[model samples]
Structures are given as structure tokens and as C-alpha cells.
Target: MHINFPLILVIAVAVAGLLALLDLVWLAPRRRRVIAAYQAQVDTPDPQTLERLDKEPLLVEYGKSFFPVLAVVLILRSFLVEPFQIPSGSMKPTLEVGDFILVNKFAYGIRLPVVDTKVFDVGDPQRGDVMVFRYPNEPRINYIKRVIGLPGDHIRYADKQLYVNGEPVPRDLMRTEPDDEVPPGHPLQSLAKVDIYEEYLEDSAHLIRHKRLSQPARPQEWLVPEGHYFMIGDNRDNSNDSRYWQSDQMPRELWGMVPDNYIVGKAFAVWMHWPEPKLSNLPSFSSISLIH
Candidate 1:
């Protein structure tokens, strides 16, 4: 099960902030009074008065010191930028497994952290933008995909080709190369005969993978509704996207166009990448670069 980290952070901040406020309003004044009283009777202070002046609850001390730091982190993560690690190859050439990316939280406008209510009119996501959002099927889990269709767009995917508003998106084949076996430990290791193509979406060109022998399933055409978007993965055949999510196994929540409010952030850059099972000769800075 996915953990609701944002909700947890919100709850933590509220609790800590409350404790800190209480300490400032009530506890601190009480402590000061006890200290003043003891000081006034310093020459012959009673044991009870001295004890009251010296002792402090550990919880109060922690709340005073930690609450400010937590509040700052909450503000930064919720509105400025947040870091995320890529866990799957759905975005492959654009984003890879183990790549740590920074998402621009305010790029699509600022939103309340846990509830995700957008409060500012920053900007809308354009076609070809890579976005991270809560998975519709499971709201707690996050998913990343490229926006292919904006509001009022007629999107079609047939025979592994894309069409927008009845015009075929230009795809210049850079080259066709032999496919690679799905690496060990991959979920789709059973898939075979994969081919790679360098396809361009508008001026932003990127690589995509497809299975040569397998026919594209369920040719689809969708008229994107207002305030909703159509998204797809760069790994066309291997991805579970808006075009191929009507399975009975998938919950109804996971189906249909993604709402604008569901967007989390625009994925801007890859800050770092580290391959698993660390190798000695691995190029340290090979994957350290800006994301397309």
C-alpha cells in the first residue's frame, strides 16, 4: 500500500505548530513566573520553588525547536519544488529508473499540499510536458506521463501512430534498430521483439519503444473534455496510459481523462541517476543532465 506522505506531513505540522503555540502562550509564561518567584526568594528559597524553576518538560523543548523547521519544509515542498525518484521505465528515454528528478510545483500553479486545491493562476500544462500526478485508480500512488492532448483536443492512437484533430502528428523516423531483451528484474521481462524509434512530438523529439511482433491493441479516439488532458507514456506499447486503461481489472477511478486538479507538478530536470548493483566502471556523470 502507498503511504500518504503529504497527509502525514500536514498532520505533523499541525500538531507541532499547536504544541509550539501552546508553549509560547501558556507554558513559557508559567515557567517565567516560577523562575521570578524563586529568584525573589533566592536568599532562602524553598525546595519546591527551586524545583519548579529548574525542571522543564522535554516535549515542550522539542516542539519549540522543531516546529519552525517543519513549517519551512512544508512550505517549500508544497509550493516551490519537490524531488521524486523514478521507479519504472514507462518514461524510458525521457526518464529512467533510479533517476532523481525535481518537479516544479508552482509551474502548474500553487496548490494546497494534501488537498491539492489550486489557489493561483500560474499556467496550464502544454502538450509534450512531462507531468507527475496522483494515479486516478489509487489516489495515494503517483504516476508520470507526457501530456499529449489538451482541452478540446481530439486525440487518436491507431497502429502505434498518433493523430491530433484528424491531422497525423509528424513522425520522422531517425532509424530502426534491433530490440533489446527486457532486462532481468523487470516486470515486463516476458515482452519480446521490442524495437526502438526516435519519434518527435512537435519540436521536442524523443525516443519511444514498441514491440514489433505485437499488434497495437484497441485503436482509440477520444475528444478531450474541458479541464481534462490526455496523457501517454514514451514507451508506447509497454505503458498503461489514457489510451489503454479500460480493463475490467482497473477501477473506474483510474479510467477516463485526467482532471486539471489532479496534476501534481511538471517534471523539469534530472538532477541525478544511479544504477543499481553498483558497478566499478560506471560513468559517474553520464546521466546527470537536463530532461527534455
Candidate 2:
């Protein structure tokens, strides 16, 4: 299962913020009074001296630390584009499994955190543009794919080719990038992954690897419903996108219909790489754990 990083960040921040607020409201004032009262008892040292329990000041210290950190993280993740590491080769070539990518959080405009309600106007996903968005099925999950179908357009996939608005999305084969698999009896051959064949996703396109000659073979047609989009991966045959699961609905609340508010941003470049050094070098969450 995909790790819900954003949700985790949100929850951690929110809980810390709540605790901080509670201390300010209920505990801070009480601690002051209790401390003052204990001082009074110390001064008197009468026969019926009352001893107060020690409040370790734990909540105050933690609130001071965690609350600020969480708040900053919340604001950054919500307003600015957040960095993400590709855990799979779903976006191979353009984005390898280990590439660290930055999402344009404000590209689609700023939105409230948690609720994810967009309150400003920014921009829309253009044809052939790569986008990262909250997976509608689960907003807690983020899925990166190229935006193929916009609202009110016809999109189809058959024989590993994309059909948009009754026209085939064209691809001009460039050259096959070297496959990463090392020849047998050589060194560790796990890094054999390579950008198979380069193809223009249209006029404005990106490079991708198909692993083999076979691409996606879904023969289906779809009308890009209003407020919805048709998404597909540059690695056609291997993508589970609108064609396979059918076009997804992009409603604002579901975060599935990826309202502009849910737009994370465009990925620009790679930042790091790490081969699994196991049977397969493609990085996984477990690999990221090892990285940690």
C-alpha cells in the first residue's frame, strides 16, 4: 500500500497544534496558579502544610517544540510545492523510481489544509502536461500522471495507444535508451532498468521506457466528463489510469476529481538515486526505509 505521507503530516501537525492550544487555554494558567499557591505554602510552613504534586512541565516543553514544527510543516506542505521521492518506476524516464520531485502546490492555487478547499485562482492542467494530484479514491494518496484528457474531451486507449477527441495521441519513436540489466555473469545486474524507447506524448511530450515492445492493450473509449480528467502514464502499457479503471471523477471533496485545489504541482528534475542492490534495483518504500 502507498504510504499516506501528507495525511500523516497533517494529522501530526493538527494533534500537536491542538495540544498546544489546550495547554495555553487550560494548563498554562493552572500551572501559574498552582506554582504560586505552592510558593505561598512554602512561605508559611504552618502545621497543616499542604504539599502539591510536581508538574514536570512536560506539556509546555513539548508544545513549544512540536507546535511550531508542525505549523511550519503544515503551511509549507499546504502552500508551497512539497518534495516527493518516486518509489516506483511508474513514471520512468521522466521520473525514475528514486528521483526526488517537487510538486507545484500553488500551481493550481492555494487551498486550505486538511479540507483542501481551494480559495484562489492559479492555473489549469494543460494538454500533455505532467501533473501530480491527490488520488481521488483516497486523497491521502498522491498519484503522478500526465494529464491527457481535460474536461469535455474524448479519451480512449486501445492497443497501448491513446485516442483523444477522436484523434490518436501521436508518438515519434526516437531511440531506445540502453536497458539497465547487466549482461549475465557480469556485476550486479539489478541496475538494468533503462529508458526503452523515447516517444513524444504529442508535440509537447516526454521520454519513457516500455520495458518491452508490448504497451497497454485496453480498447476503451471515454468522454472526458465535465469537472473530470483522463490521466495516463507516459509508460503506457504499465499504467493503471483512466483507461483501465475507467476515467476518474475529479470532484473537489473526493480529491479524486482533483479539483485545482488539489493540484500539487509539476515535477521538474531528479535530485537523487539509489539502487536496491538486491534482486531488483528499483527502489521501493522498503528501500526508502533503508535510506532513512
Candidate 3:
């Protein structure tokens, strides 16, 4: 089962803050009065007696200790930035499995965590940005993909080529080579060779890949509705992106479009890569670089 981490964090912060506030307003003053009365009765209270009188309840002590730290984490994660680990090759050649990346939370706009309601309009996603968003069909799950179409934009995918607003997006074949990064036993491994291309989307230039000799995906087209965006993965042939969101559970009209509210943040940089969890394989910082 998926854990709603944001909700949990918010609840923890609230509870901790409440306990601390209760101690400050009521319990702490009462303790102070008791200590003062004891001091009035005795000529000189020993250090041990004072310490015992001033001691806080265990629950209140824990709450005061944890509230500040939790508040800082919530602010940074909900508004500034958050780390994510890539779990699939859907964004291959750009992001690989186990690649840890940082997403700019306010890049698109600042939204209230858990509820996901945008309270400010910082900016809208531009074409060619690598965006992390909630899967429209299942908002609990997050997916990362490149922005392909904006509101009112027309997008077409045919013959493994992409078109935006009726113009063919330029893609130059760089090479056809073996991808050593392809995970073992992956379906794409059967197609040993992969074609690498430099696709230019607007001013952004990024590399994409397609399996050599693999059958082309069926052509598809989408007209992005207002308040929605179209997303596609860089691993053209291997991604489950806007081109193939059709499923029995989703309505036909909402299949290929991601709503604006589903936007999480813009993926800006990859900080590390550890392809597996074995102790022998340590995470490497060599892959640290800004996302194109």
C-alpha cells in the first residue's frame, strides 16, 4: 500500500506543535508556580530539587524537541525542493533506475502539500521541461516525463517521430549503438541495438532513444485542452506516457492529458546513481548534472 507521506508529516507537525504550545501556555506556568511555592517553604532548594521540579513530562519534552526539526523538513519538502529516485527506464538516457534527482517544488507553482491545491501562480510548464507529476489515473503514484504540449497545442506521434502544433520536431540521428545501461532481462535487451538521437524541442536539446529494428508504435494524436498538458517520456519506444494512457478505468477524453493540478514539480538535476541495493554497489556522484 502506498503511504501518504505528506499527510503523515503534516499531522505529526500539528500534533507536536500543539503539545509544545500546551506546555508553554498552561503546564509550564503551573510548574513554575509549584517550584516557586517549594522555594518559599525551604531556605535553599538543592540543585537536585530544582531540577526535579523543572523537569517536563516525557511526551511534552519529546514534542518540543521534534517540532522544529519536523517543521523545517515540511517547509523544504513542500515548497522548496524534494528528492526522488527514478525506478524505471521510462526516462532512459536522461534518468535511469536508481538515479536520485531533485525536483524544484516551486518551479511550476507552490501548492499545498497533501491537498495539492496551487495557492500561487509562479509559472506554467514550458515545452521540453522534465516534469514530475501525479499519474492522472492514480494520483497517489508519481511519474516523470518531458513536457510535449501546452494548453491548446496539438501533438502527434507517428513513425516514431513527434510533431507539435503541426510542425515536425527536429531530431538528428546521432548513432546506433549497444546500450550497456539497459538492465539485464529487460524486454529491450532482446533488441540488442538502440538508436540514439538528439531531439530539439524548442530551445532545449536532449537525447532520446529507440530500439533498432523494433516495430513502430501506432500513430496517435492529441489536442491539449485548456488547463492540461501533454507529457511524453524520453525513451520513446519504452515509455508508458501520454501516448498510451488509455485504459479501461479512465475516461476516453482524459486518456492522454495531465491536468494542471496533477503537476508536482520540475525535475531539475540528478545528484547520484546507484543501480542496485547490494552493499557492493555504492551510489556514485559522478552523474551529478543539471537536467536538460
- The candidate maximizing lDDT is 3
Which residue runs of candidate 3 sit more than 4 Å off their true CA positions?
179-191, 245-254
Pairs in steric clash, model 1: none
**Tens digit of per-residue lDDT, candidate 3, span 29-141:** 99999999999999988889899999999999999999999999999999999999999998988888899999999998889999999999999999999999999878899
- Better by TM-score, candidate 3 or 2: 3
Cα miss at 266, model 2 (Å)? 3.1
Specify the poorest-scoring 10-residue window by lDDT in model 1.
172-181
Instruction: List runs of model 1 lying over 4 Å from the truth.
Output: 44-55, 175-178, 181-194, 246-254, 275-285
| lDDT (Cα, 0-100) at 198 in candidate 1 | 73
lDDT by candidate, in order shown: 0.81, 0.65, 0.91
Q: After aligning candidate 1 to the native by TM-score, how far in Å is the CA of 50 from where it should be? A: 7.2
In model 1, the Cα lDDT at residue 84 comes to 90
Model 3 TM-score (2 dp): 0.94
Order of models, best TM-score first? 3, 1, 2
Residues 1-292 of candidate 2: C-alpha lDDT, one tens digit per residue: 7676667888887777777787778777786776677767676544333233334257666766788878787788778867776766666556666566667677767777767777887887777777887776666777888888888888776766667888876665666554543467655454444444445545665665555434446488877767666777766656665555433454323222345545667665454465444456653443221110
The digit string of per-residue lDDT tens for model 1 on 1-292 reads 7788888888888888888888778887898887887678678778786776766678877777888888898998999989998888888767877888899999999899999999997999888889998877667878899999999999998888999889887765545444354577676555455666676677676677777756877778999999998999887876788887455654543466788889999998887786563676352456677766
**Pick by TM-score: which candidate is best?**
3
